[model samples]
Target: MKNILHVFRHDLRRATSNVMAVIVLFGLVVIPSLFTWFNVIASWNPFENTKNLTVAVANTDEGYQSDLVPIRLNVGEQVLSALRANNDLNWVITSEDEAIDGTKSGEYYAAIVLPPTFSADMMTFYSNGSEHTKIEYYTNEKKNALAPKITEQGAGEVSTSINEVFTEKLSEVALNIITSLSGYLDDADTQATLSRLQARVSGVAAQLRAASTTADMFTSLIASSRPLVDSASGLVSTSGDALQDATGALGTGKDAAQSLKDVLTSTTVALGDARSGTADSYQAVADSVDDVFSSMNAQSASSADALGAAATRVQTQIDQHQQLRDTLVNDVRPLLPESAVDSFDRAVSRIDASIARQQDLHDRLDHAATHITDTDADVQAMHAEITGLIANAKASVDDAQSAYTGSLQPKLDALAETLSVIGGDVDSIGSDLSSVAESLSGSDSLTTALEHAESLTTDISSTLTETADRFDALANALTKAMDTGDLSELTEVIGADPQALATHLAEPVSLKRVPVYSVVSFGAAMTPLYTVLALWVGALLISVSIRVDPPQGAASDLPVLTPTQTYLGRFGIFALVGFLQSSLVCLGSVLFTQVQPEHPFLLILTGWVMSLVFTLIVYTFVVTFGNAGKALAVLMLVVQISTSGGAYPLQVLPQWFQNISPFLPATHAVNAMRSAIAGIYQNDFWVSLGLLAAFALPALLLGLVLRLPLIGFNQKLLRALASTKLM
Candidate 1:
């Protein structure tokens, strides 16, 4: 360890005396630091000046009347005033051309231009949907970035304020127009007209209700009348049946009477012959004939009387049936509609025709029986007269029979037929009544549904009327409020109302940032490269100086120590000196420039390690090859310096340079030092330290192995010098 210290002190003294080392330290340390200081100054505060912004506008608008007032508000002036009033902005108003030039020269960051017809165009757009009005913003590309952005934000705020104001004013004018129109409608005539219309609608509603009720009542009455018609038809049928039975009884009695009359006439004629001796019979025949005649006469008289009574009863029944028919035709038929009455009349007429036909048939029967009366005329003149009287009675019976059978019986039969037809008609009428009842029920249901619908409609109408009334009240209030026209109180709510001239001053624009610091400058970036190169060159020179002399006595004539002693001595001295030099430079940089050391100890250690590796490599060449090794050291330094990324980041360097960079000790040292300065070192610092150690160790071991030959050369040179001294 004492020997190592001796060698360490000796190499350090040698490095201090080397001219190349002095030059390397000055160039690498001093020059690079000055450049870094200049870089920091150039890139200063870029956003500070953006707070005081300026905008310019030009407007040549001709104002027009709005809502019967002359609109003399200059839009451009109003916009400029609003922007100027804002605390964040310092707006400078100017002509369009001048503003553009000022922005381009960076005097103003942004400028606004208001077109000449801005007011007229905006009004036209509102009234007629025109597209003539436009706002334009101009921004300088060379201005600071914050300046243009602030100007754009200010313009947007101004536009929003103007829109609120304009909309409020327009609403006021519209309300005034509505108020004037409403005043015209407040007269009495219109009110009276409306009242009359209401009354007419009410009348129509009442009439519709009455019509509905009447239709329902009519349908009910028709339904109730159907059963009565059915009952009347049943009564007519019963009457026809009774009349048919009476007529049948009367016919039976008339037939029996005719038979008895024939028998009586035959018996009387036999008695007459017996009594006139035209018979061959004795007193018994005459007496029998007399008795038979008398019995036959009595039976005939009784049969005739019975037949007359039957005929009379039949006539009475017929009279009752006729009376019922007449009553039906007169009373019930009149109550029916014309069509029903016509049907009843037709039925009655059919009955009458059938009666006339029966009467003709009865007359033919009466005529046939008249000859029997003529044959019995002269048996007893008084009896003949009686027979004549019976014949007359028979004729009367015939007449009565004819009346009953022909007229009455036929009328009854016809009435029965008519009643059957009427019953059918009644059945049809009942079906019609049923249909009418169903239709009436459906109509009732429909009316109920309609009533519900009408109630809903009335509710809807009432709601509509209420809404319209509320709307009219709202409109009146709004109209009255607008007529006041004092919108100063609304200014807080509506904000700034920009004139038509300033409408064109609202828009957004972009600005390109001009760099305050030249970050891409060549000199600022190259300082680190030169610093790394000088350090590597200085380390190589120190390594060469220590390897210049051999050991005190050795066979070889080389002027360096053995390789092992030479490498250890030089590397030890270089490590200490490099550490001192790195500490001094970093201290100077921090004190003078803004450059800070992220890891002070690591940076110092990296410098020491790099110096040791450089010293070992230089010792290996010089100890192995004597004076010729100096040229080899220079070549190695140049190669390592060129490959090291301290000059530029490794990414920007050629692919081959990056590949060989880790092999060089200077490359590792620079990377480690930069990491310490930048405060970003992690894997890079550790990896670089390991690589430098690898190079330093291997070089030191190789120097140690070649030291034997160097020591022998040193002994030989010392002995030769001794022999020269003895001679």
Candidate 2:
């Protein structure tokens, strides 16, 4: 301990004895502090001056014509307007090509471009399903790394401003809509109009329902008529066959009459034989007539029945048409405007015409059926008359032989005339049957009318369904609105100032940040790192410029010092110099810079302790290993700068650096200073200060124990450096 004090005092006296030595010592003390002051000042408020970083803004947007609002929209222009008012960055308005070129050429930090379709694309927000608009951002990442980050922040600010603007505009539109609706609700005339509209809608709905029912009935009528139509078709076929058979029978009867006439008029035949043959021929004609009549009777009965069923079906269809026409006229027409009434009237006329045609077909079918019944009765009467004529002819056969030229010939002629008349009547009946068949076959008008009615029914049903869905949606929306509040309350809310509401809606939430241990400026927050770094550098400078070893002859009179005592003695001088350096840096930071540490005295004390520790560590390296030790100190300084977490956090460093950070003296030094500069946690300051002081122990061991073996090697290395003649 005595020898340690002796070496410390001896070095101090030698340094102050000469003016040159004192000047050198003064340089050493002030130089390291200058490094800290200048660095702190340079980075004091770097972010505050970011307004000098040039960023290009290019607007190439075409205006968009919006149907929602009367005004044309240009989102690019609005964005540019917002940016022009912003002072966060140096904004330069230019063309797209120029902005792109400037960004690529390093003339600008970044460029934001609004393309020609920017405004048009923004209008797509009102569309149903459209992609969002894009604002092209170009950045030169090769520029200063920090500058690019600041420019990116500027871009984000622009995006946020645009969002605010969009929100404000949308709020204004919504407010306007609400105000308009409120005004409408407040007006008496509007209320009346609304009531009338509701009534008209209700009426239309009812009319639709009635029309739908009528359509259903018409469709049912068509469906039910299918069987009747088939039956009518069968009747037509049967009637045609019956008519053919009657015609053939008439021709056969006519031929028999001709044969009888020829037999009666013959010269070579006997009277009795002619009479018998005439009787047989007449009987044969009667039998054929009777067969034809029976067939006609059956066919006519079936035809009449089929015609009656078809007429009944036609009547039902006509009734449905009349009901539909009534709905169109009474319920639907009054709701229609005059211009539409003509069209409605025309439609009704068409329906009436259809009904008339259907009725005509019904009447024709009825008339044909009546004619068939009358013809059937006439055929039965004719058959009875023919049977009587055959009986009289058989009884007159014997008498007819006596009066051959007189009574027999005349009677034969009369019977032949009767047969001819019956043939004509049969021909007339055949013509009536043909007419019925033609009428039944030509019933395409009825089919066409049924098809039209079915189509109309489908259209009405679809329209009714759609209307019902729309009404349901409207009811749901109104119900939800009423659930929140009544319409009167909504109107009252809308009565407030719209602009204030719009502004509130635009920015509904705000962030309130309460900083936890706030430092005033960048330089103030960074003071701990730079001040600590300067202390290390100051220790390094002392190791290089001043000698760590006491002079060999000056300490010769003292007791021979042990290596531990020598090491402690030399570190005492370094420690004094380091304390002066730390005091100067700490005072400069507190007095001259923006740094205002919470515990200013503690900051100075921490600095002093760190300086002592750092000085001892560097001094040990140099005194133990000669010039190579100085190189090792410089290398350590470099490593500490990177790993100490002074400039950045330890977590941000590489894994190896973070692992070694806790062991580094500068790391602990910076931590202790930070605790003093900001608000100290429980034992953070003491812990850091103790960790930093602990580094001095290993340094002492290297100097006291490790150097004992390297003393010869270090001496030879010094000799070799001296041999170069540079020092």
Candidate 3:
């Protein structure tokens, strides 16, 4: 440590003793301050002076109007107004061609263009809800990157302002349309519908009043039909009873037919007996024919006359029976059902056969009588003929009896069966009619209910007719209202104040800027870079005039100081000059004068550390290689200034620069100072401070650790250069 102090004081005395060295040291103080304050004052806050940068604007929007919406849209004019009002960007309005050329020529950072169809596209959106109007934005990337970026942001703001105004105007139009619809639909507007509506109400009332009257009328009509239906039911009942009586009468008729059959049977038997007697008498007469002829000779004519009369009488009786049979057939046959008519015919046929046989006998008698009369004239003339005639009559009588017995009883049985069937059918009919009558009697309530239903139908029909009239009135009323354009009240509901609406739409959001690291101005925010550069460059100047180590030819013969002592002594001298440079730059660069740092003491501390580390780096390099080493130190200063994150963030630099940014001492120095000035202690703050401190280690190690070899190599090179007369 004493050796280091001894060398440090000796070098300090030597520097002051030389007038040129003293002047160089004084220049060091002035130069670093000049580097920091002069540049900082020149480009202090570029963004705040952006009004100097011109951005071209071209608006060729042909204004459009829509008849469907009674409004004209002039969006380009609105944008111009907004642009003129805004001071954020210097917008130069020009023709499309000029704006395009200006942007291409780099005269403007960016250009904004409104197409000729801008308002037409907007009109299309309002007319049929289609299409979007696009604002053209052209940027010059060929220009510096920051100006174009800032100009693009300004262009976006212009578009947003115009769109807000467009939306506000469009909403007003839509609101008015809705209001017009409301007015058109207002129903209270005077119309013919009022009278029609009243008429409909009157018709409905009239129908309601007639409902009971129509019902009662139906009741009366139904009541009148009940008696006629009852009469029909009664008539059917009487017909059934009459059929029953007719059935009883037919039973009596059957009994009478049986009686007649029996009587006919008895008569037939009598006729048989008479036929036998006649046959016997005829035989007797033949035997006594001679004797009888003599006895009847005198009365023969009278006898003939009597026989003729008997024959006539028999003929007359047969005619009477036939007439009676005809009367019975024509009258009584019709009285029975057709099934019994055949029985009546069979009975009458039997009677006709019997009577026919009787007629034959009578004819025979007449002939015999005539013969007798003739025989009187000629005695014993026709006795045999008369006998033969008598025999024939008897035979006929027997045949008549046979015919009556054969057919009459069978016919009577048939007539009896027919009468029995007729009687049963009549009884069944009577029973059925009685049942029908009872059913009709039980249906009295059904008739009343049916009558009520008919009454209701008439009432409903009347109601429907009245309702139809009402509906007609309603339809007429609706048509009248529509023709007059009357509907409801909504016109005043959806209205807006234009100014208020525009204000609301214009800037819907506001920005509240809260800086984590507060800097008074953009210039102040960048103070760390200037101060750090000044500190580092001060170190390079200190190495120039001051001999960093002993001359190589003389270094071998000098007092035996250790390599670390040699390094510390030289670094100590550079440190004095570096700190002195830091003080002047920090004071002049607005470290506390133009801008108040959050940590003024820490900023001074940062500057001091940066100077110390930078001086060590240069001092070690110059000591190791003499004049060549000084050249290397200046080269390092150039590399660090370009690659360091002090001027621009390392992130924005080329990748190769970023790869080495962390290793640069100036990068760490600037970061540390930035933390101090801005009052933001980010991790980079401590990391950068630690890195700056760490850089001191390598400078120290090279100055002390490999010091013997480096000094030997530097001395040898120095001698070689001196020998060539280059020093």
lDDT of each residue in 318-367, candidate 3, tens digit only: 56446545655564455444565565566566556646755665676676
Report the lDDT of model 3 for residue 568: 75
Error of 3 at 273 (Å): 99
Tens digit of per-residue lDDT, candidate 1, span 481-597: 344433343232223443321233233234588853232333323434544554556555454433345245464322445445555554565556445545554454445543445
Ranking by lDDT: 2, 3, 1
Better of 1 and 3 by TM-score: 3
lDDT of 1: 0.51
Which candidate leads in lDDT? Answer: 2
TM agreement with the true structure for every prediction = 0.32, 0.57, 0.53
Backbone clashes counted, model 2: 0
For lDDT, candidate 1 versus 2, the one ahead is 2
lDDT values of the candidates?
0.51, 0.73, 0.68
